[model samples]
Target chain A: MKRLRTFIALAAVPLVLAGCGDLSNSSMSTNSGSSKSGSTQLTGQSTDSDYEGVIQSGHYQVSKSRGVTNTQDSGNTYNLKSFENGMLNVSKKVFSTKKYVFQEGQYLSSTTVQNWLDRKSKSNTTGLNPTDNGSKSASKRNPIYIQALEEQDYMTQKNNKLSLGGVTIGIAVNSVDYYKKTQYGATYETKITQAAGEAYAKKAANTVLKRLRQKSALKNVPIVIAVYRQASNDSLVGGNFLAYSTNKAGSTSVSKWTPLNVKNYTFPLSSGQSSPNSNDASSFSNFKSQVENFFPNLSGVTAQAQYDGKSLAGMHVNITTQFYSQTEIISFTQYLQTTAQKYLPSGVPIDITVSSTDGIQSFLSRTKNEKKFTSHVFNSY
Target chain B: MKRLRTFIALAAVPLVLAGCGDLSNSSMSTNSGSSKSGSTQLTGQSTDSDYEGVIQSGHYQVSKSRGVTNTQDSGNTYNLKSFENGMLNVSKKVFSTKKYVFQEGQYLSSTTVQNWLDRKSKSNTTGLNPTDNGSKSASKRNPIYIQALEEQDYMTQKNNKLSLGGVTIGIAVNSVDYYKKTQYGATYETKITQAAGEAYAKKAANTVLKRLRQKSALKNVPIVIAVYRQASNDSLVGGNFLAYSTNKAGSTSVSKWTPLNVKNYTFPLSSGQSSPNSNDASSFSNFKSQVENFFPNLSGVTAQAQYDGKSLAGMHVNITTQFYSQTEIISFTQYLQTTAQKYLPSGVPIDITVSSTDGIQSFLSRTKNEKKFTSHVFNSY
Candidate 1:
C-alpha cells in the first residue's frame, strides 16, 4: 500500500468565481512537448472532490520571457516540454493544487531571466554560468552549464482577492552543449556528465532561492525548487527531473532534498548497443516479440520506459501495423494486452497506443495499482 | 456508403527529411478551443496508408499576425481556436493530407491582414467591413461585420523542395458585436443575424480571393474559403462553420459553395428552455437518469452533441461522480456503458469521459461505424 501524504488546505476562496479566458496554441512543437491549454470543461454544476480541485483550471499564461529562454535553451522541443511539465508535477507535490490556484511566473521579468541564462561577464554579473575563458577548444571552453529557468506561481484567494501563496522554480542544466568555434563554423559538442549537471543545478537553485528572498513579497512565500537534466539535442525522447526541495513559508533556504532518481529509456536500443538495464530490456524484448510474432503485418514497435532507481515505474508503448478491419483491431488489442500482462513487468503502469496508416486505432493501459487492463479502441465516424 | 472523393496526386516529395524542431505550448486556452501542436508522434518505421498520409505533420508555424488578429478577432479563446482549426479542417478536405503538407499562413503580411480586417475608409479602401458610421446609436452605428481572417497554405514536396500547392482562407463573422457606445460606459451587444453574418462572409471571402490572386505565386494555386459563425461572448459552447467554397486553379472566382450545416448543442438545457433537439435530448436524458438512479452519489452529467443537419453526428458526455474504489470505477463504467448503449442513439459516434474528485477515472467511446463500445479505465499512478 502507498503511504498517504498530508495535504494542508491552506486557504479557500468563497464563491466559485467563473474562470477567466483561455488561449490555445496549435504550435507544432515536437511530440513530447505539445500540450493543449485549458481546464477540462465542466458544466457549472459538476461534483467536486479534493483531488479534482487540485486539477482546477488556471488561465494558461506564458511568461513574457518564453520566446527567448525556450528557443535558446534547447533545440529539442521534447526536452523543453518535459523540463517544464516535469517541474510542474514536482511543484504540485508541495503546493497542493486543491489549496492554491496556479499562475504563470509574474514577479520575474524577462530581462532578468535573460541575464541569468548568460555566462558571467563584467557587464552581466547576474549571469549564472561560469565566466568565459575565451577558449574555443571543447576541453577549455566553459560549457554552457545552464540551459533555461522557469517559474510557476501558486496563489491563494483570501477576501476574494488572489495573492501568491507559494512559488516553484525549475532550473534546467545541459546534458550536452553544442557550439560553433567560429562564425558559421563546424559545430562541436561537449557532453556534460550527470554529476556535473546535478552539481551546477544545485548551486543555481540555491542562488535563485537566496535572490528570491531579497524581494519582500517572496520572503515568506513557501517555495519549491527542482532541477532537470535536459535531453541531448539529438535525442528522440525528453530529459528527466533529478530532484526537488521545498522551503516552507518563513524559511529562506531549501535544506533537505528528495532525489527523484528517475530515468527514461527508449525500447530496443539502437542496433548493436546494449542498455545497462538488460533485465528490463529483455522483459520489453520478450513482450515486443510476442506481439510482432502473432501479427505478421506489423510495421514496428517502440516503447519508452520510466524507471525509478532500478525499478520500472511506467511504460508507454506504440504499436504500428497495417490492419484495417475493426475485428482485427479488437483482436489485436486483446492479444497485445494479454501478451503484455504475461511477458512485461508487473506492478509498473503500462500504456499502449495502436495505430495504422489510418491514424490511432486503439489504446490500452494498466495503472500502477491495477491488475486488469483497461482498453479503448478508436473507430471511424 | 460515403462517396469517394478523388485525391489528385499533385506532387510527391522524395526521401523523408527528418522533421524540424518542435515547441509545445501549455497555453490554457478555454474548454472548447484548446489544441496541441505537432502531428501525432509515430515510431520511425511505422507502416503507412493513404488516409493516414493526409494526417502528415507540417511544422505548426503561427502567422506573424496571430498576436494582433487572434486577440482582437474575439476576446473569447474558444472563438479564436474554432475559427483557426475549423478553417484548417476545411482546407484538409480539399488539399488532402495525403498529397499536400500543411503550413501556417506565411504569404500574407501582418500589415496586410490588419488593413484587410479594418473597415473600408478613404485611406483603407481594401477594408472588408463597411466604413464606420459616426452615430453611436445601435441602429446607426455600423457594426463591425468581419471579426478576423485567417490564411493557411498547403505545400507539395517535389524533389526535396516544398512549394505552395493550395491556400485556404477563413472569415470569422461576428454573431454578436459587443461595442462600447462610449469609452468606459455601459457595454451592450448587437446581435448579428445568421443571414447577415453569412452574407458578409461570402462577400468578404470573394474579395480576399480576388486580391490573393494578384500575387504571382498564388495566381495558379487552388484555394478553399470557409466562413465561420463565431460564438457569442456570453455563449457556453462555440459557434459553427456556416459554409465553404472551393476556387480551383486558374479560376478567379469561387463558383460553388457547400454549407457545412454543423451545429453544436449543450445537453440538459437550463430550466425553462426547450431544446429544438428534443429527440436526441431525451435519449441523453434517459441515459443520464439510468446511471444516476443506479449510482446515487452522482453530482451531475453534461453532454455536447454535434448535429449534421438534423441527424446526430457525434456526442461527448462528461460524467462527474464521487465514487473511489477501483472496483466501483470498473463496475460503474461497465454499467454506464450498458445503459448508454441501450438509451442513447445508435449509429452516431459517442464518447464519454468519467471523472471523480480524483480526476479522470475511465473513458468509454463508440465510433460511428462500430456498434459495440470500447472503453478504458484510467487508474491512478
Candidate 2:
C-alpha cells in the first residue's frame, strides 16, 4: 500500500525527538516483544517547519506531557518559534533523527517550571533564578534573569517498550529583563550583558540536569543542554543558541560546553552599516538588483540571512510583489530560482518566498547540498 | 507556460470582493480605456477558507487601505473568522462574484473606527454604540455594545478603470461586554439579549451609511450591511450574522431588512435536549455511530451542524483518532468517505477532518448538492 511504503521510508530515515515514564498508568508501554520491529508504524507530523517530528515505532498513544510557555509577553511569538527550532537544530547535531522518538518534556510541570523561574525566597527554594534583595530602588534590586525553559525528550525501543534515550533542554535568558514595580506600573528593564546572560544560563543548566536526574527514568541517559540568549524586547526576530553541551551517559552535569557563534543579519543594512561577511552581503545585494529589474513594479525585496560564525548557513528571502497574474508570477518564480542558484552561497540551504498584496504567491526552496530548488505555486485564483 | 493557463482559468472564475476612491492619490486608476477587459488578470489568494479572494484584472498595485482589528481580546479569533465569512456569504447573494473584484474596506480608517467604537462624548461624537451614563455599579453602566467593524469592497471594471461596484460592512456586537472597573481590577460583564444587540446593530448601520455618503466617491453606490452577534468570550465557535439589508442603487438608506434565523448545534445534542429538526439530528447521530464502529480506538467523534431556519445547511465533523500507521490511516479515510456518503443529509455540504494524535491525517468533503465526496489523504510518515 502507498501508506505502508511511506512508513517504511521514515523507518529508515534519520530525523528529531531526541522520554521516560514508570510502567504503571504511564503513556509509555511495551508490546511484550510479540510484534517484530518491521511491524512498527512510523507516523510523522511537523507543527513547526524548523523541526521534523519523528514517527513512533509502535501503536499510537497521545503524549501525556503538556509543554508550557513561561513569561509570555506581547510580540514574543517570533521568539517562541525561533527558540524551539533552534533547540531542534541543536538536537539534530548530537542525536540522529532516525534513532530517537520525540516527546514533550514530561518530568517538569508548568507549575514546577513557574516556581523555578521565580526569584528564590523562603517558600520557594526550587527557584533557579537569583534571589531578590531588600532594595527599594530598581537598580539596587537583583534582576530576574531566566525567562523560560523548554524540555524535549527522545526515546528508543528497549526491552519491547520505548524508554528515555536522550534529552534536550533549552534555557532562554533575557538580554533585557522586563520587570514592574507595581502591577499597574509601566514595565521596567534591566539590561543584561551577554557574558552575564551566558553565565546565568550555564548555572541554570546545572540545576536542571540535577533536577532531571531525580526522575528514575531519566538518570542514566545523555542530556543535551543548550543556552539561548533571547533577543531584545523589541526585536523582530527570535533568539539563537549561544552554547550547547552534551553530558555523557550517567553524567549529572554537562561534560563540556561548545560556544556557537551564530548571528542573524538583515540584508541591505542601513546606511553606514555592513555585515561581518562582505561576500554574502554583496551576493544578496546583486540578487535583489537583478530581481528588481525583472519586475520593475515590485513593492520590496528583502532577506534575513543566518550566519554561522563567518559562513552563511541559510538565507530566507522575502520578495513582496504587486503582480497578481499567475503567468507573471510563475515566470518570475522560475527566473528567481535561476538567479538564486547563481548568486547564493553554494551548499547552503536557501528559502525564497514570493508574496503579493493578496497573499503568498510562490515558494522556491533548496535544502543543504541540493543542486536544484523545489518549487510550489499554489493554484492561483 | 504552465502559469499562463492558470491565469486564464481564474479570469473566468467567479469569487468574492464585491470599492471607489478619488482619482488623486487613490489606489484606483485608469488605463486610458485602451486595454480590453479580457486582457485583465484575475489572481486570488484566500486568507480564510470560508471566503474566496478575488483576482484583479489589471497591472497589479498594492491596496492603499490598511485594515484594522479593533477591541481584540483573548479567544476572539473564532469570532473574527465566522463574522468575516458570514459577511461574504451574504455578499454572494446580492453581488455577482464574476463581475466584482475584492478589496478591503478603504473608506473607514482604523482611527475613525476606533472613535466610532468608543462611547459618545464631547471628544468623540462619531461613536455609534451609546453614551456612557457614568454609573458606579457595573450592572447599571452602559455596556460597550460594539466589539469591531469590518469593511469589504468589490470593484467593477469601468472605462478601463477598476472602480467601486458594491460594498459589505459587518458590525460585530458583543453578547457579553468585557470591561474592568479599574485599570488593574477584575473584568466585569453585562449580558446583552439578542433583541437588544440586534436593535443596536441596526442603529449602527444607519450611522455607517450616512458616514459613507459623506465621501463623494461613495455617496451613490449600493451597500450591503450585516450585523453579527459575537459569541461569548469563552465560546469555541464564532458568532453568526443576525440580519442583513441592501439599500437600492443610488439610495442613501436601506430599502428593507430581512431577519435570518440561523443557529449552530452540536450533534448528539445533550441528553433530553432536541434540535429544531429531529430528522437532521437523527441523521448525524447515525453518522457518528457508524464512524465510532469503524475505529473503536478513536479519542472522539463530534459534529457541528448548522441550521438555516428549520433546514439543515451544512455540517463539520471532527474525528480524533490514535491510528498512526499510514496504511491504517488510508484504510480509515476510505471507510469514512463511504460512511459519510451513506448517512449524511443528501443535499448539504459536509466536511469531515480526521486527525490523529500527531496532526491532521486526511480530509473528506462534499459540496452542497454534490453526489460523491472528494477525499485527500495526506502522505503520513
Candidate 3:
C-alpha cells in the first residue's frame, strides 16, 4: 500500500509539472504573436498619421501617356519614327489639354497678378534680383512676363531646346484666404479687442474665396478652403473691449467698449473635390467663366475640383502710395469719389483717414483742407 | 632716236608710275595711321567722357575706417586640466596700428542694420538674412529660406531651434535719389535718365567702374555714392506728386495751371551762393543736421563735402519711414492735426499715399475734420 501511494504521488507530480510547462509555452507563443501583430499595427497607424495631413491638405493626381510608332526603311530596317513624333505629338496634346488647368488659379486674379508684378518691380528695394534699368540693349532689358501664357510659352520654348525635347505641363490648384479690416476705437488695446465686429469672419471668408475663385488659374482645380479667426487691437490698452473715435463737430475722442477685436478671415480648404459630384457645379461654372473672360486663348477641360476652408485672420493691412506728382492721383481719387457717391447711399458718411508715410505726421495737419471724401492722401516717401 | 625715245618714255613711265605709287603709299600710310590713331584717340576720349558726369555732377568726398580688434586670442594649448577648468585666456588689447584709407568722394550712405530690422518688424515681414527670425528651424521645415523664416516666426512656433550655422549675411549701402513732391501738380521722373539730370553721366561712369571693380572683391570694397537731383512737383498733378485728401468741407474745384504743374521747384539762392556752390552752405548744413539727428549711433568723421548751386535746389530726396502699426501712424497724424498746428502751415496741401510691400497703391483723401480720418482704411489679404 505504501509503495502504491508513493507511485501515485510521483505520477501526479510529473503530470502537474508537464501541465505547468505546457501553459508556459502557450502563454509565450501568445505573447510573441501579440508583439508581431502590435508592430504591424503600429506601422499602419504611423503611415495613416503621415498621410493624414496630406489627405487633409488635398490630393493632386497626375497621369501621363506615351505615343509610339514603327516605320520600315528601304533597307528592310525598321525605324521608330512613331515614338519620336508620337512623343512630341502626345506632349503637345497633353500640354494643350491641361493648358486651361494652369490658367485658372491665383495667377488669373487681377489683384493677385498685379501684386506679383508690383513686388517684382520693387525688387530693387528688397535688393533681390537686381535689374539693370540703365541697359540700352533690348536683350539686356528685363521683360516683365505679365501673362501666364507667356510664361508657359517661354518655359516650353526653353524645354524644347534642351534635352527635355517635349513640353512638360503641370497644373496645381490651391486654396487661399481673404481678409478685411474693421475698426473700433478707444484705447489701442481696447480697439483691437472690439475690432472684428460680428459677421466679420464669415464675410471675410466669403469675400476672399469668392474673389479667388473669380480670378485664379486654379479655380477649376480641386481646392479646399479653411477659415480662421484671430483677435488683436491697434491699441495697447488690453482688455475685453475695442477703441472708438467719437466725432463731436471736428474733434475726435477715443473710448473703449465691450467685444474683443476678433476678425474672421477665410482661407482655402485643403481637401479638394476628389471625385466628381454635383456639388462642384457652381465652382466649375465660375471657373469656366473666369477662363473664358481672362484666358480666352486657353483650351482644356477642368480636370479636377475641390474645396477647403482656410484663412489668414487678424492681419493688418497697410497701403502706401508714393506720389512723384500729386495731381494725377488726386484727380483720380476725385473721380473715384464721384463714382462711389453715385453708387453708395448718400447718408453713409464717407469717413477717410490720411497720414504721412514719412515719420513727420505734421503733413496731415498742414494739408487737411486738401483731403477730400473721394481721396484720402497719405505721404509715402 | 627711237631707242632713246623708248628709253626716255620707259624712264618717264617708270618715274610717273613711281610717283603715283609713292603718292598712293604715302596717302595710304597716312590714312592707316590716322585710323589707328583715331581709334586710340577715341578710346582716350571715351574714358574722359565717362568721367565727365562724375566730375560735372557735383563733388563730394568721404573717409572711413574699421574699428580695431579689442580682444586677441592667446596662443595657449589646452590640456585636460585646462579643459576641465573651462577658462580660456584672451588678451584684451587696443590696437590702432592699421589705418584704412577713404578716398575723397561721396560715399554711399551705410544703411543702418537697425533700419532693416525696423522695416521687417513694422511690416511683419522677416528673412533679411539666413539667421533672421527663426530662419534655420523654419528652413528645416520648408524648402525656401524666406518662407521658412516667416512660417517659424510669424505663423507658429511649434518646433523652432535658433541655429546660426550655415547662414549667410549680406550688407549693402547705396546712394539713392531723394524725391519729394512739390506744390506743383507735376511729377518728377526720378530715375537715372540716359543723358539728362545732374548725375546721369556720373551714374553711367559709376556703373562701368562698378563692373570693372567686381573683378576683385577688394577693388570695390568700399562703394562711392553720387547723389543726383532733378526738379519735381510736390502736387499730385506733378510728375513726382502723390495726391492725397485731408479735409474737404464741401465740393471743391481743381485749377489747371502750368507752374502749378511745374516739373521742378526752385529755391531762392542766398548771397554769395552761385552755380556749383549754391548748395554749399544752407543745403549742406541742412543735410548735415538731418544726418546727425537721424544717425546718432553712427561713429565716424566726415572727410569732405561738396555741393551744387542752390540749397535744396535741383535735388531729390527719397524718404522712407516705417511704423510699428498702421493704426499708430494714423493716430500720430491725427495728433499732429490737433496738437502740432505750428509745424503744419495752412494752404500748403499735404498728400498721403499708402502701399503694401507688394506696391499696391491706395490713396487717402484729405478731410477737414479729424473724425472722417478714421474711415479711409484698407486691409491686405
Q: Quick one: ranking by TM-score, best first?
A: 2, 1, 3
Listed in order, each prediction's TM-score against the native is 0.48, 0.49, 0.20
Candidate 1 chain B: 10-residue stretch with minimal lDDT: B1-10
User: Which DockQ value does candidate 2 get?
Assistant: 0.03
lDDT at A244, model 3: 15
Clash statistics: count for each candidate:
12, 8, 138
Which has the higher lDDT value, candidate number 2 or candidate number 3? 2
Error of 1 at B319 (Å): 2.4
Query: Residues B1-381, candidate 3, lDDT per residue (tens digit)?
Result: 000101111211111111112222121122221112211110000111011000000111111111100001011111111111111000000101011111211121123222222224444443231222432231131111110000000010111211111100111111122222446544322233322332232333233234324434224232212121211223211112101111111212212111111122212233553434433334434333322222113211111111212222222122223322222223222222221122211222233333333232222232333321122223222
TM-score of 1: 0.48
Per-residue accuracy of model 1 over B1-381 as CA lDDT, tens digit each: 001111121111111212311112212211221122322211111111111112122111335454545643345545654565466567767877556655557788888898888899999998998888887777678888888877777767544345688888888888888889779988877778999999988988888889999999999988899998888876655678999998988687778899998777778877776655687899888777656533434447888777778778787787887652333455466546545776788898798878776456678888787765666654322
lDDT of 1 at B337: 55
- In angstroms and one decimal each, the interface RMSD of every candidate reads 17.3, 13.4, 35.9
lDDT of 2 by residue, B34-139 (tens): 1225434333322222222323333322223233443443545556546766776788677765456555576777788878888899889998768889874667
- Fnat per candidate, as a fraction, reads 0.00, 0.00, 0.01
**Candidate 1: stretches off by over 4 Å:** A1-313, A316-381, B1-60, B72-77, B121-125, B182-184, B269-278, B293-295, B323-330, B356-361
TM-score of 2: 0.49
User: How close to the true structure is residue B374 of candidate 2, measured as C-alpha lDDT?
Assistant: 59
